[model samples]
Target: MAVPGMMRAVEIKAPGGPEMLVETTVPVPVPGQGEVLIEVAAAGVNRPDVLQRQGRYPPPAGASPLPGLEVAGTIAAVGPGVDPGAVGRRVCSLVAGGGYAEYALADHAQCMPLPPGLAMEEAAALPETLMTVWHNLFERAYVASGDHVLIHGGTSGIGTMAISLCRLFGITSIVTCGSDGKCRAALDWGAGHAINYRDEDFVEAVKRITGGAGVDAVLDMVGGDYLPRNLQCLAEDGRHVSIAVLGGAKAEILIPQIMTRRLTLTGSTLRPRTSAFKALLVDEIMRTAWLFVAEGTLRPAMDRIFPLAQAADAHSRMEAGEHVGKIVLKVR
Candidate 1:
């Protein structure tokens, strides 16, 4: 395969709105040590990308300033210490940055083989959400089969993946979404129950669904006022894992409830974590979840796709909160 000297990428020209994302030709990135250059076929649009474009979240030191977090494509080149055979292999990767491009660099360890029968766009949708949900729900919360978990944003990429994973693992999931249609989507995706947050209080709904025992864990993206209610919806010794603060960041928690209920509150960000840490997760996912993916039991719920040049439109759709699942950029 011929590698181009220059490639198109979406650059954040300034901190502002979706209009800030501009497609322009830039030098294709060269893979560094332990890295591989990917000819990006598709890229997933995530909330963090929106934050980065708004200047609220900057890429970590030594990372690409481009906003995308995950991409799927063929390896175009391999850097020093990486096997030359990696070139030409199809993969989906969790990139620190630089994914919104015709070509991008990814750490070799973060790349996973694309599951059989999945399109590039479907594979592109997996990396960021899959890793985040695995790290938070299974790794931190120690969620197990048969445990009842409550998920917020039930139709978003992370929420959809969480529901599918729970179904694969035999866990019961209850989810909250903004609309009744979204709730039905969640249930169809394997959530045991769905609450329309617009029409019902999630905490009350969780209590009702769980027969007053409450859920064993709660996966929250809405922070602010949701914190106390999330804690309230947890059963004794339950865990609450937050991955975003979409509503707001600050919250007043009832310390007494946490102590009395033996609850655990924890969270983590994926991009800043060390490559070695993410590699471990990649290995685990390949071993465990990849089987489900290969068997078609676990798949990405795709909402829409836009051409690479229409990256700003993709971001606008994500910002509108109208998407039911992952939004992807069709790079090729």
Candidate 2:
């Protein structure tokens, strides 16, 4: 494969709305040490990308300023110290940035080979959400088979993935969605229970659904007032893992609730983690979750696909919150 010197990419013209994402020609990025250059086939659109577009979340130091977190493609070239044989291999990788382009650079260790049956678009959708859910739900929350979990945003990419994984692992998922249709979609996706938060109280629904025992864990992406309410939905020794503060960053919690019930609250942001840590996460996922991918039993619930040039529209759909699953941009 021949690498290009310049490539088309979407750049943030300024911090603002989806319209700020402008297509332009820029020098293709070179892979640094321990990295490989990927000829991007597709890229996943995530909440962080939207935040970056709005200038709320800035790229970490030394990371790409462009807005893409995950991509799936073929290796076109390798940097120093990387195996030359890696070129031409199909892979999906989690990148810190720069995936909204014709080509992107990814850390070699962060790359996961795309199984024969997986589409590039599906592969592109997996990395960021997969890692976040795997680490938080399984690793941090310590959920096990038969455990009941409460997840917000039931129809979102992360929520759907969590529901699927919980089903595969024998855990039960109780999810909250904004609409009745989304709740139905979540149940069809194998969530044990779905609550339309707009119509009913999720805390009360979880209590009723669990026979007043509550859930073993809460996978919360919505913070603010929901924090205290989330605590009210947890069972004894239940874990609360906050992955995003979409509702609000600050919340007032009753310390007595946590202390009396032996509850645990924890959260993480993936982008700033060391490459070594992410590499280890990649390895772990390959050993465990990758088997489901290889068997064709696990795949992302895709919502929409947009051409690379229509990056703004892709972001627009994601922001509108009508999407039921992952939204991706086709770069090929």
- Output the number of the lDDT-best candidate: 2
Tell me the TM-score of model 2.
0.99
Question: Please, what are the lDDT tens digits per residue for candidate 2 over residues 188-285?
Answer: 99999999999998889999999999999999999999999999999999999999999999999999999999999999999999999999999999
The alpha-carbon lDDT assigned to residue 32 of candidate 1 equals: 89
Off-target runs (Cα >4 Å) in candidate 1 are none
Q: Write down the worst ten-residue block by lDDT for model 2.
A: 198-207
RMSD of each: 0.7, 0.6
- lDDT for 12 in candidate 1 is 98
TM-score of each: 0.99, 0.99
Residue 120 shift from truth in candidate 1, angstroms: 0.3
